[model samples]
Target: MSLNHVRPWKNIYRRTSRQIMVGNVPVGGDAPIAVQTMTNTDTADVAATVAQVQAAAEAGADIVRVSAPDAAATTALREIVRESPVPIVADIHFHYKRAIEAAEAGAACLRINPGNIGDEKRVKEVIRAAKDHGCSIRIGVNAGSLERHLLEQYGEPCPDAMVASALEHIRILEDNDFREYKVSVKASDVFLTAAAYQALADATDCPLHLGVTEAGGLVSGTIKSAIGLGNLLWMGIGDTIRVSLSADPVEEVKVGYEILKSLGLRHRGVNIISCPSCARQGFDVIKTVEALEKRLEHVKTPMSLSIIGCVVNGPGEALMTDVGFTGGGAGAGMVYLAGKQSHKMTNDQMIDHIVEQVEKKAAEIEAAEAASAEAAE
Candidate 1:
């Protein structure tokens, strides 16, 4: 049973938007908020870019974006899209030709600003290519790269300016009879990102792609994204999300899932609820969790595990998780399965034991779900 079932207040009333397919994966219309990350590799290096995309897909990325800044990159995109396990979004800047080339190369989506892709002729050519190739477009509006007119009008890159820029780009797509698209209004500042998204959410029914652009390196970026994306998601604004970090794309996928998991919006793998160890901890809590995380990365089952330091709040937390370990006296801990004290194990052997238990529990869950579906059929 989900916590939301028992606690109605936990429900996030998601905003309804028209769904669009990014390759086979669905975005919007109550679909899972797709997680996205961009590869920093030279797009011309097909092997390297494809490897990065695969790594991110294995880590649960629903979509991956690769830059197609030039003709060479767009040519390489053909092979990259062929080999990629998840949807490939070709990132295009001011060059409309790259947009057309990427669409021809089998990109699932094109990330372009219709306003920046030269005059109406170039924009229409890009739009026609996208339509001919069944590619969705993403109108990404960033505060740092706001149009000069918008900047002059608003006198700054504010929420209003960002929203206006996005609306202008959206108007171009709408004018071109392109509705198979999503929009994003991003900023490095959390307040601006959240405010723009909030305003945009009210202004249009298009599926939103949420992000805080240029959000620094791993730690700082994750924090900024969690705050910015987290708030908008809580308000039922986003339809898909990308956590912009200066780290590896795999890290971005992991962080994106973690954010969605924290909000109970989406779940994948083990959702660990471990405590920061204190002096009262019977086992090495930090090390144990680190080992468990790496060991259980292969488990794609959505489940929770609580590793609490002591009885202070251990048993209480254990009661809610699918599997739990609570520290106790004499270098031993209690293993709780399905919220019941099932057994005890020494600290030295607990990590392996916990892994085994979680794997067993996940298999059981999968089997039961399969049986239920079979019965329905």
Candidate 2:
């Protein structure tokens, strides 16, 4: 394709409400779309919880949520909060006391499914405690369990019912003069969840936390979450997202970023554009792309790179990326840099050569960013 033929990138986005801070990282308003994950370890186990929290942080999770189920779990919060690399969210259920305990223990945020958390007075206490501790709250209303009155009114856990439930919870907090919070109305069913969130988005300006609850194991879960969250995000509905995979929490963070990237919302790491192999593939496309991906797993750059299997589509794709390789003729590949042909290398040298070039480009980018930061300072 010629330069003039290149299609202009159309804006496929709806303006998200706005960004709001969840701790330091912004969730909805104008903040970068944050990637959040939950710790599966027992929250009272300080070492394991801290380790998991740190692991999620190291794995690029912008925030980590852990369950504070009991008084012991609340006690562990102080230490866990002190050690967490990113702000910590305490997931409290049913127990208003635990919410207060978590708030006092230094949780940056508290996540509670308000429908199940009991009376208005208790809810008010939870809100007051959060206000006292400078903590935010998430009124996470789930489809699995809803307020009995709503269930009777709607007959089943429908989108309208869920939205109503979420509003009721939001009303409680707002009436109590507590406004520093986010909301999530998650349903195991993607359609229901997405619809509910869209409805809620209209009814409130509070930032939304997107997820497809009980999203099954890796493959199905990621797909469901992507489609559900991605659709809303494309419509400018979500502020922060959690890809609730039944796999490792780290994988959740990875998939969260992937969804954001697919929507052109954010890019945190190497965005590898690789083609599926055909007989035309001159090199081992799978192995090379996999190797490159694994090696650059920790490289936190927003640069796009292409690793194509064959020469036919390679050049076009490579030209669209910041850097890349085009495979052709046995054991040979051409490198593309800054949308132009840079050089050619043999198959065996591909990985090393690509890595070296990427490292150099990344360093240059980092240096430029540092210089910009210093100039701003």
Candidate 3:
């Protein structure tokens, strides 16, 4: 049962979009928004790139992208694609040949612009390669990298200019009879990103990929992406998302899931709801949360955990979460399971005990889900 069914105001009506496949994963339509991250390693080094892709996949990336710059990079993409747990998107910029190579190398999708691929002949060649190799294309238009003619006409990187650029790119693909593609118009500015994506959403029914390009470091980027992507997602404008942070690719995947989870759009792994520690805390709330976060990273079950500092709001918060711990006197805390008071334990045993409880709860959830699936089948 969905909470939105009871609270009508909490529901988000998603924008309608045609569905496409990035390998086995579905995008647009009723598909859960796919989370993506790009590897920063040199693509020529197959070992490093494959390891990075696997790490990001482990962190819950539905799709991972790698740069296929030169011949060397595209050559290595073959092995990387074969070994990757998730679908691989080959990022090709200013190189038509690289796009062809990547498509032949088994990239699930090719990230490129048809307008920039030399001439119409070159564009057709790349599109043909995509069709031949069953690769979908992503027409990514960044505000900072718009065409010179568009910049001249608009006199700036505005939403209108971004949308115009994306439409033009879309036209090239349409002209070539290619429709298996998704689109993204990204900018570093949150306002610009939101406006561009919203405009694009109204313009076409194609799957929209959301991202605020070059969104700073971990802290700043997460906030910017949350604000920009969050608003767009709330309005139901995005079909997929990538949190472009200047951090590890795994960090990007984690942030993407967090954004989706916050909106109740998608759920995977444990969702920790911890309060900001105050003087009322009976134990080290800050350190305990940090430890729990690391310890529970391996649990991919979708559920909630609350760690509150004091009894003031802990009980209320616990009533809604799957597992919870509220601080109390005498260096002990009250534990809640399935949103009900379960037990009390000293602070020393709390961390290990919570970890054990979370793991057990995750297993139970998985088993129930398996049973439900089997019963339905």
Best by TM-score: 1
- Per-residue lDDT of 1-377 in model 2, one digit per residue for the tens? 11112234745555556555667877776777788999898888999999988888887899999988889999999999999889999998988999999999988899999788888899999999999989999999999989999999999999999999888888998898888889999988999998999899899989899899999999999989988998998888887888888898999999998888777777777788899999999899999988998888878866778899887899999878877899889689899987799998999999988988777777777787788899999
lDDT to native, each model: 0.91, 0.86, 0.91
Tell me which residue pairs clash in candidate 3: none
lDDT of 1 by residue, 147-263 (tens): 888888999989999888888877877898999999998889999889999999999999999999999999999999999999999888899999999999999999999999888
Candidate closer to the true structure by lDDT (higher is better), 1 or 3:
3
Q: Cα deviation in Å at residue 356, candidate 2? A: 1.1
Ordering by lDDT = 3, 1, 2
Identify the superior model by lDDT, candidate 2 or candidate 3: 3
TM values, all candidates? 0.97, 0.96, 0.97
- lDDT at position 97, candidate 3: 97
**Ranking of all predicted structures according to TM-score, beginning with the best and ending with the worst:** 1, 3, 2
lDDT of 3 by residue, 1-377 (tens): 11111246667889999999999999999999999999999999999999999999999999999998899999999999999999999999888999999999999999985436566678788889999999999988988788888889999999999999889878888998999999999999999999999899999999999999999999999999999999999999999999999999999999999998888888888889999999999899999999999999999988889999999999998888888999999999999998889999899999999999889888888898788999999
CA lDDT for candidate 1: 0.91
| Runs with alpha carbons beyond 4 Å of true place in candidate 1 | 1-6
